[model samples]
Target: MPSKSPTPGLKRRRSGIYWCATHQAVQAGFRPSVARLPYSLENPDHRPLIEANCQRLQAEMLQFLANGGREQPRRYDGTIQSLSGLYQIDAASPFRRLKHNSRLKDTYVLKLIEAAFGKRALSALRIADFYRWYDEIKKPKRPGGPERVRRAWGVIKKLRELFAYGVMAELPECERLYTILRHARFAQPARRRMVMRLAHVEAFIPQALAMGRLSLALGTALQFETALRQKDVIGEWEPIPAGAKRGADDFVLNGRRWVRGLTWADLPADLVIRKATTKTGAFAAHDLKLCPLVLDLLERIPSEKRTGPLIIDEVAGRPYAESAYGREWRIVARAAGIPNQVWNMDARAGAITEAEDAGADLDHIRSAAAHSQAATTQRYSRGAVGKSRRVAEMRLAYRGLRNGP
Candidate 1:
C-alpha cells in the first residue's frame, strides 16, 4: 500500500519546534514517531532555549484556559503574577511562614497580606506607603491603628525570612525590599513618646461609669486601669454576695451575681496573658486584679448565670470581644463627656502613671500591672519620676537659701 498519509486527525505544525495541536503534544526530537507528550509550562524538561519566551507563552496559554477561550480577563494575569512573584518576595511569602510559626491568627495576617499586595509592587513601595497606611488606619472610624502597623511589621519581618535563610538564598531582591520597608513611614502621625498621666485615668472612669452600660464600659476601663487584657477579664466571674452583704457590697442584675473586691483571690488566679494565637498578637492574657473603682462599677451591673466573662454584653449575653468593646467604649466615653482620643491601653498606662504620682513603688506598680519586665512599667512612671526629681531639687534649693548657705 502507498505510504499512509499523516493521520488526518493529527495536525502538525513546525514554525519553531514541531508541535501537534490536535494531539495536544510536542515532539522531543526530529523523529515523527517520537513519543507524543503533554506540555507543562513549569516543567524543566522542555529544554526551553529562552526562559522569558517560554514563560510568556506558558502564561498566555494559562490565560487562554482561564478565560475559557474567550478574551482575556482584564488584569487577572497581572494580579496573579504580581502576587506570585513580587508580593511573594516582599510580604505574602513571609506572612505565610509567620502564620505557621507564630501566635498570630491567619485571617488577620492574610488580610494584611492582601492589603500589601494591593498597595504597590515591592520594588515600587516606598517608606511613604507605610506612613500613609498607618495614618489611614488609626482613625476612630478605621478598623485598626498603630497596633495594626505593629502587627504588620511583624508580618513583614516574617516575609524577610524567606530571603534571609531559605531556598531563595541567592535572591538579592529580598534584601533590597527589606531595606525599603525598614524605612517605611508609619500610617499614623508619629507622636513623641510621652509618659501617661494619672489624670488620664481619673478623667475617663467617671464618664465610663455613668453610661449605665457598666458591664462593658467598666470591663474595658478595668482592663485599661489594671493592665488586664480582654481575655483576662473573660476568664473569671464577677463575685457574688451572700446574705445582707449582697446589697451592702454586691448587686444583682438580670438574676446574675457580682461582688466588689480587688484581690488575687477574687480574680482568676490561673489567668496568664501570653501572646494571643489570634491576629494582631499584640497584647496577651494576665492575672490582673481590678482596682477598687473598677470593682465598684462591676457591683452595679446585673448578674447572670454566665460568669466566665467579667465583661459581657447583656444583650448578646456573650463575652466581650476586643473589637466590639473598643467601639462600645468610644460611645461610652463620648456619652460620659470624655475625649474620644483615649484608648483602652492608654487607660492602663494612665493608671500606672497615677500610681507612680501617688508615691507607689515601681516594683509594686510593676507587680500590679503584671508586666513581664520592669522597663515597660518604667515607661509609664517616667513622668512621675522626673517630677519627683524636680521637686527634690527645689526643696534643696529652698533649704539652702533659708539656712543662708
Candidate 2:
C-alpha cells in the first residue's frame, strides 16, 4: 500500500515528538505536555505509546469539532504573532535602535508586515507567499511615476531590515526570512534634487515671519546657507542637554530620550556651525559656514530659544514637525508668488549652486553640503559650474576667430 498522507499541520521532528502543529486549538488551563504527544516507534512498548497518543489526539479533535472547528489565534509558539510580540520587547527592540523619525516609518512598515503574516505560523512562510504580496502592491503607480514605487521600495527594504534584525536577535528561521523578504523586490528611481533661486528664497522668508510662521522662516534661512536637511535644521524631537547654563551658545543638546537633529551646541559659532547628529549616523560634527543672511537670522532669535534648539517652534514651544513646517513653507511660497515647483530641500541645492556661482571649488562645496561623495556635490552644482566652463570655452572660441582672420 501507498504510504498514508500526514494530516495538515501535523509535524514530526527528529527529537521523536509528534507536535500538535494545529492552529488555534484550545488548552483549557492545560498546556500540551510531552507525555500527551506521540513518541517514536523505537520506544519500549511502542504500540502502547502510539495508542495513548492517538487517544489524546482523538479527544482534541472531538473537542475542536464541538467548538465549531476554530479556536482563537493566541501568541502561540513559533507563530508570526509571537515574533511580533518579541519584536516589541528587549534591548534588541527596533524602536530602541532606530532614531525617532526612522522609528516612525519602521513602525508603519512593521504594521504592514504584521497585518499580512501576524496570524500565520512563523515556520510556514515561503518565498511564494512573498511573491504574491509583492504582485498585489505593484498594481498602482501615481502620475508622479517614481513616488509611489519609491515608498513601496522603502517598505520592502524596511521589511528586509526587520528580518535582518531578527537574524541578529536569533529569531527562528531568520536566515530563511531574509531570503524570502529579499525575494519581494521593488524598484527605486534615481531622483534629481530640486534647486531654488536666491530671488525666490528672498521673497519668501520675510512673508513667512510676518505671518508668524517662524519655523518656515528660520528653517529655510538655515537650509539655504548650510545645505542641511529639514531635520538637521529644525531640531527634530531633540531636548536641551541636562544641567547646562541657559542663554549661552555652549549649552549642550544631549537629550535622554531622543537626539537626532540640530542641537544648541551643534551651532556654537554664529558664522560657521556643525551638527552632532546627521543622516549618515556619524558621531563627528559636520561643519557649515553661515552666510550674512543666515548670520542675521541667527542673531534675531531670542536668547532663551537660542539656548535650547537651533530652531524652536515658537507657538507650540517644541520642534517643528516635517508636515507642519511644509504647510507653513507652502503658505509663504504662495504669498511671495514663488512657483509651486519649489520644496524646502530645494534650498540646499540652491545653496550649493550659489557656492559654485561664487567660485567656491568642488571640495569646498562638498564640505559645505556635508555630502559623503564629491560626485553628489558636483551633481547639485552642475548647472552653475557647467555654465562657467561653457563661458570660458566661448571666450577661447572668440579669441581663436579674431587671431585666425
Candidate 3:
C-alpha cells in the first residue's frame, strides 16, 4: 500500500506547480481514486510557496467535505506552475472531460510548455513573452524553422482552445495571458500548402493513365472524382438505412469515422459518398455528381465486387497502401509533365476550390466538403496563388458594342 501520510508542506519544482503534501496525505486517507483526488496544487516559482499549505488547505478541504460540500474543482492561484499542476489533476475532472487521444496530445504539448515556463508565475510571463518565444522558434539556427514555428504555434493555438472559464477558473493570470495572446498573430509568413488547380482536371489524370501507371492514376482519378481522402479511398462503403431520411436513390458509403474507417461489407447500393467525418478538423459528405466522367469511373468498378476499397491495388491483394499510392503518383506525374509541387492529396482541395469557384450553391459545397459548420466554406478560396505575381490587366467588354479588337 502507498504511504498513508506524506510530509506536510507545499513545494515548487523546476517543471513548475506547487504541491501540498498535507492535502495529498488527506486525500490518500480519504480513499479517493487517483482521478478523484483534490490535489492541493499551487505554485511559488522554484521556491516553496508555503512551508505547509498541507496543514491549512487540508483542514479547509476536510471541513468542507465534512459539511457535505460538493466535489471541489481542482484549482490554484494563477501561476504557470500552478496551472500546470491543476491541468494534470483536472484532466480526469468531470467538468473538463477530454477524450483519450486529445488528452495525450495535451500531455505532449504540456511538456513543451512546462519546459519553458513551468516554474514561473503564469502571469509573470506577458503576452510578449510568448511572441518572443515564437520569434526564436522562427529563427532557429537549425533547419526546419518553418516546421518548428508551425508546431509551436499549434501549442499556443491549443492553449487558447483549451482555456475555458467554466472548467478551470482558478488561473486568472493564465486567462489574462490567453486573452492577450488571442489578439495577436503567433506565426508569420503564412505557409502555403500546395494543392491541385481546378482548370487542369480535364487533362491531368487521363494523361497519367495514358502513361500506363494504372494504380497511381486510378487512385488519383478516384480522389479527383469523389474528393475522398486517401484513407477513404481504400475504406468501405454502404448504403443508407431503409427507414432513415434519405432519397430512394441516395446511398451512403461506409465512411471513415472519428475512430475507424469502413471496409468491404459496408458498401452501399448506390454511389452516394458520405464520409461520416474527416481527419482534417471538418466533416464532408458528397453525393457523387452525375457528371459523365464521374459515372464512367464508377462504372469501371466490377459489378460483382460488392465491397472493399473503391480504388484498389489488385496486385497487393488488399487496399492500395498510401505510400505505394503516392509513389506511383509521382511516377505518373513526372511522365505526364505535372509539376512536382502538386500533391495526390491536393485533389480534394482542388475540388472544393473548383466547386466554390464555379459558384456551386453554398450548401452544396458544405455538404460535399463536410464542413463542420456552414460558415467554414467562407475560407474556401480559389484562383491562382500567384495572381499577385502576374501582371494585372483588366479588359471590360460592353454589353452590345466594344472597342474594335
Residue 230's C-alpha lDDT in candidate 3?
A: 64
lDDT of 1 by residue, 1-405 (tens): 211332221222221222222222212111111212223334453333223223333444444444555334323222313343332223324543442223124323433444445444545655665556555444443455224544545455544443243224333345666566556543433442443344544555676656556675566556655665444554322313223245543334322343222223344544333433122334444433334555566556555432444555665665442245667767766765566566654655666777777777777777776676779878755346645866898999999999993
lDDT for every model? 0.46, 0.60, 0.52
Q: Please give the lDDT score at residue 361 for candidate 2.
A: 77
Model 1 residue 143 CA deviation in Å: 22
Best candidate (score: lDDT): 2
What TM-score does model 3 achieve against the real structure? 0.55
Q: Which residue runs of candidate 1 sit more than 4 Å off their true CA positions?
A: 1-172, 179-189, 192-210, 234-290, 301-306, 381-391, 394-405
Off by over 4 Å in 2: 1-81, 93-95, 122-128, 141-147, 180-185, 189-192, 238-270, 280-290, 296-310, 317-323, 356-359, 375-405
Q: Which TM-score value belongs to model 1?
A: 0.48
Query: For model 2, what is the error of residue 80's alpha carbon versus the real structure, in angstroms, after optimal superposition?
Result: 4.1
